[model samples]
Each structure stands twice: as structure tokens, then as C-alpha cells.
Target chain A: MSDKHMSSQFDADLNLVSSKVLEMGGLVEAQITRAMHALNDFDIEIADQVIAAEETLNTMEITIDEECSNIIARRQPAARDLRLLLAISKTITNLERAGDEADKIAKRVKRLAEDGSSRTVNIAEIKLSGEMAATILRRALDAFARLDTVAAAQIVRDDKAIDEEFRAFVRKLVTYMMEDPRTISAGLEYLFIAKAIERIGDHAKNIAEFIIYIVKGTDVRHKSRDALEREALS
Target chain B: MSDKHMSSQFDADLNLVSSKVLEMGGLVEAQITRAMHALNDFDIEIADQVIAAEETLNTMEITIDEECSNIIARRQPAARDLRLLLAISKTITNLERAGDEADKIAKRVKRLAEDGSSRTVNIAEIKLSGEMAATILRRALDAFARLDTVAAAQIVRDDKAIDEEFRAFVRKLVTYMMEDPRTISAGLEYLFIAKAIERIGDHAKNIAEFIIYIVKGTDVRHKSRDALEREALS
Candidate 1:
């Protein structure tokens, strides 16, 4: 084959892999939504569906990772192409873990259903945070597909809102548990659910950070928000 | 350069990266230990040290990751060498996050110290679990250094013990909070700390899983314990 032909072929391969990542991201987003629905309505079937989907998500991660390795070996991609492959590898890991967080929420909802306790503690904050996490995750995936560092930086900043909401929710749960001892067990379960949602938001933020790194060749992880924004925008 | 000389140079590069990984692992292990001691004794000085060390850990992760990418770009490593580089990239991520968990423990300890609430609930179980987590993390790093799948599989199994300890401790804490509302605030703090330690164990298990993958060319993550053991031994 001509050199031009080989280069285009490599580009095609990269495109294919990028598409698979988006497909996986979409499925993960769906899992979070279904898990949250199960939690809000105490719906067992939806929870079970989310639980069963975990295996599929895990398999997708391994498959995509192997594909990345194969491409690197065959093409010997360098520079920006190499960095994009590396970022994809890391992005899929975050997506897989986000799926796991959804699975965790589903399992907790199932347990809460089994206990047959009336939902005394209000979980409105948790439900709202779950939606926020799912929304941020969707936006992050969009930013990744478009390679939009501006949007990615915005997602990074948006993650802090979810954290604040989580802290406020935890405080409210503590107050409820203290005022009424009977609500302690249920409140703890809600706390874990809220934590799962917060982690989902974090995973989304991680994907956004990878976008900045892929585009700017500057890693924004573990940096202050201001520094990350400057790097992503610069 | 001759082919043989080039191959030896590549080997030296891999060795250097591997040793750096171990050095980072050692520092992360110390972070966990110091954070736990700070938690146990409510010592602000040690807690401050753990928090301060986080910047160093973050920098090490980025530097090591960059080194991995550079090796891939320069060496165009194939098959096992490529796999090792990819695994190193992922392993450093887990190590860095484990360091984050330690920082979390330290920050929580600082908060608890400021609150000045008498330790009403016995956290002996949490303390024991923290030790177990640290020991397993050390073992996992050793397994990685030696490429010992047998030891890696054992670390995977041992992680279950820490999870059980966490569950038992949470159950006990729930009862305590129900009995005495005054302990509710401090109990929640301990709960978060216990959760952080559990996450450390999870990260260690992830590193062990990567080691198994590097050696056996199989992905053991999200697999059943029996399946993982059989693959590791086989």
C-alpha cells in the first residue's frame, strides 16, 4: 500500500475507536438514568435491568482497550494521534467506573425496597443531583466528540456544584437521622446513593479533563479550578 | 545502532519506568499509613504532612505517565512491551487515586479534630480495616513488581475481607447512632473515613488486576473470584 493509503487507514481506525467510545458513553448515561428512576419509584425491574447491564459495560471497556492496544501496535502512531489513543484508553476506564456507580445505586435501591420501610427521609436533593450528574456526563461526552475544550472546561467547573449539593444533602440526612432514630438506616442508604451520584459527576469531570489534555497536550488533572480553566482555554 | 543494542536500550527504558512506579508506590503506601495514624490519634501535624505530600504524588503521576507515552512514541514497542507500557499508564492512575484517598482521610481527620467531640463510638474495626487495606496495597505492589499472578489473585481475594469489615463497622455505627443521637455527627465522619479506606483497598485490587492482565494477557477486572483465580493460576 502507498504511504497515503496507510495513513488514511489509520485515521479510519481511530475514527472507529472514537465512535465505539461514544456508543459506550451513551449506554453509561442510560444506566445512570434508569438507576435513578428505580431509586425514585422503587421499581425493581428497572433496577434489575441496570444490574444486568453492568456485565455488558465491563465487556465493552475491555474490548475497546484491546482495540486501542492493537491499533498502537499496528500503526505505531506518534504525537497527537498517540495522545488521543492514550486519552481514549483512560476515558473508557472512567466510563466503565461510572457504569459501576450506576450499578451500585441500583443494588442499594433494591436493598431499600426489600427492607419495606416507608421512605421517611426526603431524597429530593439526591434525585436532583442524580439528574445533574447525568446531564454533566452527557455534556462531557458531547465535548469529547467535538473536542471542545471550552465546553470541557465548563464541565469541570460545573462539577463543583454537584459536590456542594452532595455536602448539603449529607448535612440534611444527618439532621434527620439525629432527630428521628428510626430513619438512621434509611438515611445512610440515601447517603450512599447520593455519594454514587457524586462519583458519577466526578467521572464525567474526568472525561472532560481528558478532552483538555488531548487537545492542548496539557494535563489538567489534580490542578486547581483556576489553573485547569486557564490551561484548557489557553 | 544495531538491532540488539536498540533492543537493550528499550529494555533499560522499561526498567526505569517500572522502578519509578515502585518508588511512587512506596510513597503512596506511606501516605496511607500516616493518614491512618493521624486519624487514630487526631494528630494535626501528621495530617498536615499527608495533605502536603499530595502535590508531590500528583506531579509524580503526571511525570510517569508522560514517560510512558514518550517510550511508546520512540520505541514503537510491539506485543508484550506495548502492553506493559499501557498497563504502567493505568497502574499509575490507580496509585495516584490511592494517594487521593489518603489525602481524604487526612482532611476528615482534621475536621474531626476541630470538632473536639469525644470519640464516643469505638472505631477499632475501622482501624483494623485501614491496616488491612494498607497491607494488601503493599502486597499488590509487590505482586506487580514480580509479575506474580498468584500473589495478585490472592490480593483480589483478600480485598473481600476489608469489604466485610466495612459492612460490619457500618452496621455497628448505625446502631450506635440510633442509641445516642449525640454521636451521630462524629459517627458520620468516621463513616466517610471508613469509606475512604475501602476505596483504597479497591484501588489496590485494581492494580493487582492490571498485573494479572499484563502477565496473562487476560482482563480479570469485573470477573468472579473463581474465574480470576483459575486464569491467574492457569
Candidate 2:
């Protein structure tokens, strides 16, 4: 192949891999949404569906990762192209783990459905946090697709809000459990569900960080919020 | 440089990267050990030490990841060498997260110490699980260094034991909290500590699976135990 032809082919290959990542992100977002719905309504069917979809997400992760390795071996991409491939490799792992968190939520919903003890312990905050996590995750995927560091920096800042919400929910759950031992069993379940949502937010933040890394060639993970924002925005 | 000289230089680079991984692994293992000791003894000093060490681990992860990228861009290593570098990159991420988990344990220990409540809720099982997690993590790193698929498979199998121990501990905690509401707050802390240990074991299992992938050229993650063992041993 001519040099120009090979360069275009490499670009095409990169685009293909990028699209696959977006497709996987879409499926994972659906899983999170369905899992939250299952929790809210105790819908065993939706929970089962979410559980079943996890295998597909796992397969997608493995496939995308393999594609990245193949591209690295064949193209020997350097500089920005190489960084993009490495970032994608890491990004998909975060997505798969986020999907695992969604599965955890679905499994807990199934357990709650089986128990059939619908008690009102006020899970409003947990549900809100779940929504926020999902929204942030969607935004992260969008930023990744566009390589938008500005949006990614915003995500790094937004993760703290989810963490705050989780702490608030945990405190409330503890009070509920202390007030009524009957709620302790179910309260613990809620705690885990809230934790899963928080983890989803974390995975989203991780994806956002990877975007900044890809765009700027800077590792922003493990950096303070201020440092990360400056690196991503500057 | 001659081709042989270039190959030897590449080998040295690979060895340097591997040793850095092992060095990082050693620090993480120590962090886990100290975090557990702090939890068991309510030693705030030890907890502080663990928390302080986390920044070093974070830096190590970023440094090692950058080295992998540099090697990829410069050497364009193919096949096994490429896989080894990628695996090392992924493995350091897991090790760093495991270090984060240990930091979490330390922070919780600090909180418990501040609360000054030495309640006698049976945490022997949690302690045992912590020890198991650390041991498995150590062995997993060893397996990675040697590319020992047999040991890696065994670590994957052993992760189940940690999960069972976590379940047993949670069950016991729930009973304690139900029987006496006074232990609810402390019980929840112990629950989180146990969870951190379980997650550590999970990170170890992931590292082991990577070792299998590197040695066997097969993706064993998200596979059934039977399938993983067959691939690893065959």
C-alpha cells in the first residue's frame, strides 16, 4: 500500500475501534438504567434482562481490547495514535467494571424481589444518586467520543457530588437501621445498591480522566480536583 | 547499534519495567498488611502510615504506565513482548487500586478510633479474610513475575474463599446488628472493611487472570472457573 493509503487505512481502523467503544458504552448505559428501574419497581424481569446483558458487555470488552492489541501490532502507531489506542484499552476496562456494578444492582433487586418485603425507608437520595451517576456516565462517553477535555474536566469535578450523596444516604440508612432493626436487613441491601451507583460514577470519572490523558498526554488520575481540572482545561 | 545490541537493550527495558511493577507490588502488600493491623488493633498511627503511603503508590502507577507507553512507541514490541507490556500496565492499575482499598481500610480504622467504641462484635472472620487477600495478592504478583499459570489458576480459585468469608462475616454482622442495635454503626464499619478485603482479593484474581492471558494467549476473564482452568492448565 502507498503511504497515504496506509495512513487513511489506519485512521479508518481507529474510527472502527472508537465506534465499537461507543456501542459498548451505549449498552452499559442501558444496563444501568434498567438496573435502576428494576430496583425502583422490583421488576424481576428487567433485573433478569440486565443480568443476562452483562455477558454481552463482557464479550464486547474482550473484543474491543483484542482489536486494540491487533492495531498496535500491525500499525505500530506512534504518538497521539498510540496514546488513543492505550486510552481506549483502559477505557473499555472501566466500562466493563461499570457494567459489573450495574449487574450487582440488578442482582440485589432480584434478591429484594424474592424477599417481597416492601418497606418504606426513603431511598429517594439513593435513586437520585443513581440517576446522577448514569447521567455523568453518559456525558463521559460523549466527551470521550469527541475528545472533549472541557467536558471531561467537568466530570472529574462532578464525581465529588456523587460521593457526597452516597455519604448522606449511608448516614440516613444507619439512622433508619438504628431506629428499626426490622429495616436493617433491607437497609444493608440499599447500602450496597447505593455503593454500586457511586462506583459507577467513579468509573465514569475514570473514563473522563482517560479522555484528558488522551488529549493532553497527561496522566490526571490520582490528581487532586484542582490539578486535574487545570491539566484538562489548560 | 547492531540488531543484537538493540534486542538486549529492549530486554533491559522490559526487565526494568517488570522490576518496577514488583517494587510497586511490594509497597502495596505492605500497605494492606499495615491497614489490617491498624484495623485489628485500632492503631491510628499505623493507619496514618498506610494513608500516607498511598500517594507514593499513585506516583508509581503513573510512572510505570508511562514507561509502558514509551516502550510501545519506541520499540514497537510485538506478540509476547507487547502482551507482557500491556499486561504489566494493567496489573499496575489493579495494584494501585488495591492500595486505594487499603487506604480506605485505614481511614475507616481512624474513624473507629475516633469513635472510641471497642465493641465486641466478632471480627475474626474479617481478619482471616484480610490475611487471605494479602497472601493471594502476593502470590498473584509472584505468578505474574514468573508467568506461572498454575499458580494464577489457584489464586482465581482461592478468591472464592474470600467471597464466602465475606458473606459469612456479613451474615454474622447482620445478626449482631439485629440482636443489638448498639453495634449498628460499628458493624457497618466492619462490613466496609470486610468489603475492602474482598475487593483486594478480586484485584488479585484479576492480576492472576492477566498472567494466564499473557502466558496462554487466551482471555480468561469473565469465564467460568472450569473454562479458565482448562485454558490455563492446557
Task: Point to the candidate with the largest DockQ.
Answer: 2
* Candidate 2 residue-wise lDDT, B1-234, digit = tens: 012325788989988999999999999999999999998889999999999999999999999999999999999988778888889889999999999999999999999889986555889999999999999999998998888999999999999999999999988889999999999998999899999999999999999999988878888999999999999999
Q: Evaluate every candidate with DockQ and list the scores.
A: 0.88, 0.90
Model 2: pairs clashing at backbone N, Cα or C within 3 Å: none
Residue range B1-234, candidate 1, lDDT tens digits: 012335788888999999999999999999999999998899999999999999999999999999999999999988667878899999999999999999999999999999998378899999999999999999999998898899999999999999999999999999999999999999999999999999999999999999888888888988999999999999
lDDT of 1: 0.92
Give stretches of model 2 more than 4 Å off. Answer: A1-6, B1-6
Which TM-score value belongs to model 2? 0.97
Cα RMSD for predicted model 2? 2.5
iRMSD of all candidate structures = 0.8, 0.6
